[model samples]
Target chain A: MQIVLAIVIGAAFGAVLDRIGATNPTVISGMLTLRRIRLMKTILLAIGTGSILMFAGQMAGLVDVGHMSVKTAYVGVFIGGLLLGAGWAASGYCPGTGVCAAASGRKDALFFVAGGLLGAAAYMATYPAWKASGLLDGIAGGKVTLGAVPGSKFDGLFAISGDLLGIVLGAVFVLVAFVLPDNLTGGKTPAEVPAE
Target chain B: MTLDWKLGGVLLGLVFFAAVLLVKPIGVSTQFVILNGIVTDVVNPEFITQTDEGYTSTNAYMAKSNGKYAKNAANPVNYSFIFVLAMMAGAALSAFGRGLDREDKRLPAIWKANFGDTPWKRYAVAFLGGFIVLYGARLAGGCTSGHMMSGMMQTALSGYIFAAGAFLAAIPTAMMLYKEG
Candidate 1:
């Protein structure tokens, strides 16, 4: 039953990803470079809207707090995130987008998938070393939220209601999305600018 | 035809929201690991073993979670794995819906402007980028979708921090790589 639902939901997610220009490396790199920010604005809007809906849903009992999965806070997580960002800018595809792009018939994306598999395999081979380095150790209370939510098993860093905090932050993101200019560089993208 | 970016974004938000509300938070990278395990297990034939207590892997990473990862790799037909596959199918469906005559079919315009029109070069870059991104994702225990998008939505502090770290490096790296336009 869940598997069938996964197909429906996953399909919708991929379709949305494709439609948003996420499957295009050009759009991604453009956003990263601040040359073109239509995609970034879209991203911000999506996240903000999602956050508002999710947090509000939780509060309204429409969403389950128990299903909330909080990743362990670790130093490696931060470091890995930095690495992923660099990769994202260079390749213009994250894992999900890469897969979607490949399916969308971007031949380069197939190579990306191959490389990703190899990378994951490499991580598996070296997992013990990372584990030994203690980088995976949870920091600041292993799994925690910024604000406290009533039903979740995780702790909150602050006493404020997490649901409300989420709503506020979400709103802020939406505001930023609305206010942000199309291009931080105040010029057309490289493709449109023409070679000098 | 492609949807407007803002509309697409809202739809994305709704899709993510619906997934979380109905099931578990959406994740993709872990499936990469599971795929690796499945391939390795197939090759070695002894990489994973189904025991009296479920499943276990020769690799410690897979052995964690009481062999939960091992189980996924061994079984290979569960919800998460299917979700990832379905994601691909959905993307293909979307592309087909777009008529395959979309602009930037082979190479997007901006990528060509900066990197030139070499398909192999783009492929190499894409490969390297995918490699590094997945490595980092595994290291961080999540990727953009898992940590940044879903995590922030749930208001997890790690999510916020990961987003900060990602942009911190992403922006500079992007600037360094493509100084044109």
Candidate 2:
């Protein structure tokens, strides 16, 4: 029952992402280019909204916060973030968006997905060699939470509180959707678009 | 016709509900360990050791110190990992079914000019990018999934910082690439 629910929910979220023109490389790239802030706004809305809901749910006893996982590795995170950013720029798709794009039938997305899988496989293949020198490993902190790590818990509380903010932001996104006309994305190239 | 909001909504609802029901939560970082186990099993059996060092057992360094594989080969595809994979697949199926399957060809002029005809360059770039991301993900102790989804869900401070880190890198990389394009 639970697994079935999981699939159904994920699929729906994917659908919304697809409909919103999120899976398109052009749209995501546009966010960076400043041609379109839609993607950025949506991401902010989702993060802001999602966090708030989760917090509220936990506070209400509707959700179990302990089962949730969190870890802190400042060095690894800082570096990994740099790499992920570089990759997203060059590839025009992150892991979530790539999957969504592929489903939307983009050839580039297929490459993106293939690359992710192969890259994952590659990481595993090299883990042993990388691990041998202890260059990649660091002190393991069990499950550091807002309470455990450095930094004010206020921000953590703010994230949950942001749920109310998400409502306002989400409405704004809808407004942007209306104001921005379609074909803001240039149409398909001659080769990509099928001839009549 | 109404954006299938009902369908999308129901599915998303299910994701949250199901997560709470089964895995007690959902996350993506564990998938890396499973992949590591599978790849290690196939590529280098000698890499895995046999020892017990608690959570450190999963750390590449501690694994070496304790004499065990960084990822427990005994259970590579843990139920949680499988759940994450399933979520991706489920989302794919739903989106693809709606006739939304098409690429947006908003290529930056440079890429279009230099490698427009060839897909391999982009593919190579994508592959290279993944390598960098995984190495980072491993070091970060979690990918976007574990940190963003699970960590944030728990209201952990690191989750927020990691999320910020991902965006911080993402914004600049996007700027450079798109500008070049």
Tens digits of per-residue lDDT for model 2, B1-181? 1133334333333444445434454455445455556565567665554545532343343254343335444454445544555655654665556554223332323355335655667666665765566556655656655565545544555566667777788777766665532
Pairs of colliding residues, candidate 1: none
Best by lDDT: 1
- lDDT score at residue B51, model 1, on the 0-100 scale: 93
Candidate 2, residues A1-196, lDDT tens digits: the string is 5455545555554556565445556555555545455445444444434444554565566656444544654555656666666666666666666666665556666666666666665555566775564544433343444432122223322323433343343355335534553223454222211210
Candidate 1 lDDT over A1-196, as tens digits, reads 9989889999998888887778777778778988878888888888899889988988999888888888889998899999899989998899999999888888778888999999898898899999999999999987998999889989998999988998998998889988998788877554532221
Q: What is the Cα-based lDDT of residue B73 in candidate 2?
A: 47
Stretches of model 1 off by over 4 angstroms after superposition:
A188-196, B101-103
Q: Judged by TM-score, which candidate is best?
A: 1
Name every residue pair that clashes in candidate 2: A8-B11, A9-B11, A9-B12, A9-B15, A104-B101, A104-B102, A105-B101, B49-B68
